[model samples]
Target: MEQQRSFGSHTTGTLYLVPTPIGNLGDMTIRAIEILKTVDLIAAEDTRHTQMLLNHFEIKTKTISFHEHNTQMRIPELLAKLANGETIAQVSDAGMPSISDPGKELVRAAIDAGVPVVPLPGANAATTALIASGLPPQPFLFYGFLPRKAGEKNRELEKLAHESATLLFYESPHRVGKTLAAMQTAFGDRQAALARELTKKFETFIRGSLSALQTYAAGDLKGEFVIMVEGAADKPAVDVTVPLKMQVEAIVATGAKPNAAIKLVAKQNGLAKQVVYDAYHELEK
Candidate 1:
């Protein structure tokens, strides 16, 4: 395991992971501004987008685009600069770098190359939304964004459905409604919140059951969304004396669909969903 003292003496230049305001410019921290001003260069996810933030702060530090498309080519160059003792600060268009954004690749490269990787605390949409979500906060799983494809997304949601910690996700406005609907199906109508246009004049949050938020998402959806869902309730021990299929059938008798019952039984017994699914369908065969 490699240890690093952020400000400790190091031969190579440091890589600063700076965070920008998610929406409100006021959210930008003083230290973040100072780092951006002092760093030898700024590796931005989008040079044009970052230019606006720099213009606001009157920062003249030069910036280079280091987004997804060019990360493979840029990591070596950035590493070379760092090796030469040229400090660089990486920033996304908004919020912290590498949170559903581009920056992790360079961060890994920097660490592997023994360059000091220092992260500055600042704005982040997930935690910012969580505080006001009215859901349990400490134990949270921040799954930035789900897979875009339907099957992959559903399978991912199924895996997370049993988590006892609050779940966080970032979603585009256009797909937020569908995502909420999908969550409702996989995780039931659990408590959830949708925050959008965060820290901006039109900032808004819709809090309710997943079903309710899904309904609202069908309307005028605006801004990037931070979706927070309360985790699954703790499950009681399953009776080891009874068969797993019978236990699943008991849940189905309570008005739950067969698949939902199977999933729930699997979670409660700490078994794989597919295992419970096969057991439950044995009678059908």
Candidate 2:
């Protein structure tokens, strides 16, 4: 276990995790601006994107690229600079660094090297959208983004189907419809909210059932989306366990193809597809 006194004197320079505005420039904090101006160097996810922010605030601090592709190569260099007592500030293109971003590895390296990691809280799209989501806020899970692949995404949704906490997810407009449909299949006709262009002038939220949101997303896709799903309702404890083959049969009876039923059964039971396949074929025989 390591304890960090952010302002304490240390042999190495501190690594500051600074959060930037997601969309609206006014959301940028004064403290964040001061840190950017005073840090020895700014490690940015995209130098060009960060340049605009710097230009707006008139911050002359130099920035170096430290995105996903170059993280491995840049961590050591950034650590060496910190070791030499040069304060480093890390920022993503938007929002907080390392939240589904590229700063996590560097932060880990700095911690291991005994360097202080100071976090300056500011804007975050998930929380901003969550507060206005009309869902229970205390017990909410922030699931950044879903898998791009249909099968993998389906498996992931299956795992999260029984979660009691409200669920949050980031989704691109182009794929929101498909994702909503998948959620409908996995979680049933649950209430959900779709927030897009958060913190911006035209920010909008579409609140409805998963099926309705899926229909809405079928229109002209626009900006980034934050999907907030209502949690599963509490049910009295009961031993409602059914056989795997029986479950597959039930799904097949609902007009799903045999292979599709097998896949759904495997995902819901957290079993390998081959295992479900064998069991299903045996039952068929």
Candidate 3:
């Protein structure tokens, strides 16, 4: 149990979670700049990348490297500084720290040590793309960067297939097409939008069905990508008591291929495909 009074007087120093610009440096907030200027130390995901931002703003505060590779070793050192009442600011390469970045562990450690953690509002690629996505804005899930492996990505998509809230994801230029294609298979050609190069001069948003976006991405996949997918339409309540084998049969009776029926039944019932396959085959026999 940790209590945080952001501006309260405490013996320990506060940890500021500062958000950097996702692309455009102009997106950096005034408060973020002030905090960066005054903080005792800045723990940046990429010291060299952050140096450019610091130089642009003329911020002279000292900085140290704190990214994925060195997080385990850096946490204890950062925590020690915080314990010594040295205010520390954590910033990622872009956007808010710990939002698909490298500040979560340090923040967790600071909280466990009873240190205050304060977050400043600033530029975020996910939310920036979301507002202009032309899809339902509220009640969206920000899933930053899907798994790279095909099977893992498919399983993750399977879990989210029934979600009713708008879905958001970050993908690299190289993986955007493949990710969109996977989304098409899992979600079945839902309304989708792809936002790329956000806040930069070449920013572009492509809105259409998932299939259409996949095709568009295939041609020229450059710049970072933020994908916003319309939610699964409100499905009528399903009867969970129905036997898995019967569900497969019903889908098959509707002219769906046996293999496709098994997959559909497995997804609907939240059962393994093998389980549904075995039951369906036994029913056939």
Q: Judging by lDDT against the true structure, name the best candidate.
A: 1
lDDT of 3 by residue, 130-213 (tens): 999899998999899999999999879867877889999999999988998888767677899999999999999999988788
**Candidate 2 error regions (>4 Å):** 237-285
Query: Candidate 3 — which pairs collide?
Result: none
Candidate 2 clash total? 0
TM-score, candidate number 3: 0.88
Better of 2 and 3 by TM-score: 3
TM-score of 1: 0.90
lDDT of 3: 0.88
Any runs in candidate 1 off by more than 4 Å, and if so which?
239-257, 266-285
Q: Which lDDT tens digits does candidate 1 get at residues 132-231?
A: 9999998999999999999899889988978999999999999999998888878877899999999999999899998789789889777899999999
RMSDs, each prediction? 2.7, 3.9, 3.5
| Candidate number with the higher TM-score (1 or 2) | 1
Instruction: Name the candidate, 1 or 3, with the larger lDDT value.
Output: 1
lDDT of each: 0.91, 0.89, 0.88
Residue ranges of candidate 3 with Cα displaced over 4 Å: 237-283
- State which candidate has the highest TM-score: 1
lDDT of 2 by residue, 163-259 (tens): 8899999999899999998887777678999999998888999999887898899999899999999987663332238877777787666444566
